[model samples]
Target: MKALFVAGTGTDLGKTHVACALLAAARSRGLTVEAFKPVVSGFDPHAPDDSDPARLARALGRPEAWAEVSPRRYRAPLAPNLAARLEGDTLRMDDLVADCRDWLSTRDVELALIEGAGGVMSPMTDEATNLDLMAALGLPVLLVAGSYLGTASHLLTALEVVRARGLTIAAIVVSENLDAPDLDQTLALLRAFEQQAPILSAPRAATWDADALVDTLLA
Candidate 1:
């Protein structure tokens, strides 16, 4: 299966937005797609509408996938490791990686997307981080960043980290942030790293074209 791991510079930077767009685009082209976010914090099973997994499921036209998409969920609205500890549970790195592998093994699809919680260095367990998980997965990364202030620094820092770890980057997407200054400048800054990977820009969610975005991602 062709897989892409969606990671962001920080939390709420539209990782899900990009992942859902890719799923929608793939489905539009009649390509079977599946998405997973192995560990999710701030998830409420009762109020599924407010959860990222649910949003991804809705985008994929599979409401039932919400549960399967995020098997390790905590309601504390904190980092996965901290939240798991608060809930009297433990997040073992090996177990988390095994769960992802098990899920992938069961799927037969053209594209499988794995969305990470928080930023690349966010801790999944006390001993391992999302970056470690990404390396373990051994898939190209679709790095997501916001066009907000200081984004240039954050984006470059993330790029350095990804490179230091020797992970392949499929692309870098700058998700529009309404509170941000001129995005043209942000795009220009990202373009400087084109040699690292393709850099793409995305409009707000309301006006985003999944097909077009997918075309860029695949390119």
Candidate 2:
């Protein structure tokens, strides 16, 4: 499987946006794609029953059982470990890895895009983090970042950690999240990163053209 983990410098950094873009792009190119959000911490209190795994299933036109794609979910809107602690639940890294391997075994897809919860350093369990999970999966990383101030510092720090772990960096996608009015600065930053990293940029809104981004990745 040509798999990659889509992670970010921090939470809400458009990791899902990038993952979905990659999936759509690969599928368009005749590659079967599957997505898994290993753990989602936050849930809508109003719906109470909502799971991000369900949304992912819908994106891929999969069945409701696809909610099983995620190994864990917590009611609190916090890091997985903390959330689990709040609910008096225990988390084990071994179980998390086991669930991921099981999902990989059963899924019939050419490429799997595993989306991490929160930042790369965020704790998935008391003794493990999302970075550890990525290392366990042993796939290259496609880092998703935003174009705000300190983006370079944030991305560089993340790159340092990823490199220290000896993980392959497939590419970096710098999104200009639509919530911001700054565009020129973001473009300049993107250009700067391309000098060293395989940097791609899109507008915060409709910032991606699936074909182009996928082509860049494959290139």
Candidate 3:
């Protein structure tokens, strides 16, 4: 199946937003899509719908078991590994990979989008990070970043590291952040620095140019 991993430079940096947009766009184009948050922290059992996986479920329109969307969940709003440890539970990279692969391998899923929990370097398990999981899955990454200050440094750093591992960066989506710099300048800087992958701007509270963004990836 055609798949993309929505990876962020850091947490809450618009991974889910981009993924949801793409999911909606792809569905509009008559393609079957499935998404997985896989391992999520900061889960509140009381408000189950207030979580990332639920957002994904809403976008996909497949309301079934939450575990199918997110196998490992922790209540503490911390890194998955730390949260898992606090509950005396372990998160194995093998298990994480298996869950995502199973979702991708489903025959009816024409496209799969796996959303990462934290930044690329964030630990998913005590021994492995999001990067390791990406490497294991070997899916093209649609790296997500924010248009806030210091984003250039973080985006460039993430781009370099993902490239260093010989992984294909499908594209970079710079989501608008509160108190961000000039959006045009940020996009220009990113394009000048990295010509290989297209950079798509995701403005906050504005209509997204979903057509171009989805077409680029589906290309």
Report, for every candidate in turn, its global Cα lDDT versus the true structure: 0.87, 0.76, 0.87
Weakest 10 consecutive residues of candidate 1 by summed lDDT: 205-214
Please give the distance, in angstroms, between residue 78's alpha carbon in candidate 2 and its true position after superposition: 0.4
lDDT of 1 by residue, 175-204 (tens): 999979888998987787656687788778
**lDDT tens per residue, model 2, 75-100:** 89898889878878887888777877
Model 2 CA lDDT for position 58: 55
User: Which of the two candidates, 1 or 2, achieves a greater lDDT against the reference?
Assistant: 1
Q: Number of clashes in every candidate structure?
A: 0, 0, 0
Q: Which parts of model 2 have CA positions greater than 4 angstroms off?
A: 45-51, 63-66, 179-181, 190-196
lDDT for residue 19 in candidate 1, whole number 0-100: 85
What is the Cα root-mean-square deviation between model 3 and the actual structure? 1.4
lDDT of 3 by residue, 62-94 (tens): 755465788788999999999999899999999
Error of 3 at 117 (Å): 0.9
Better of 1 and 2 by TM-score: 1
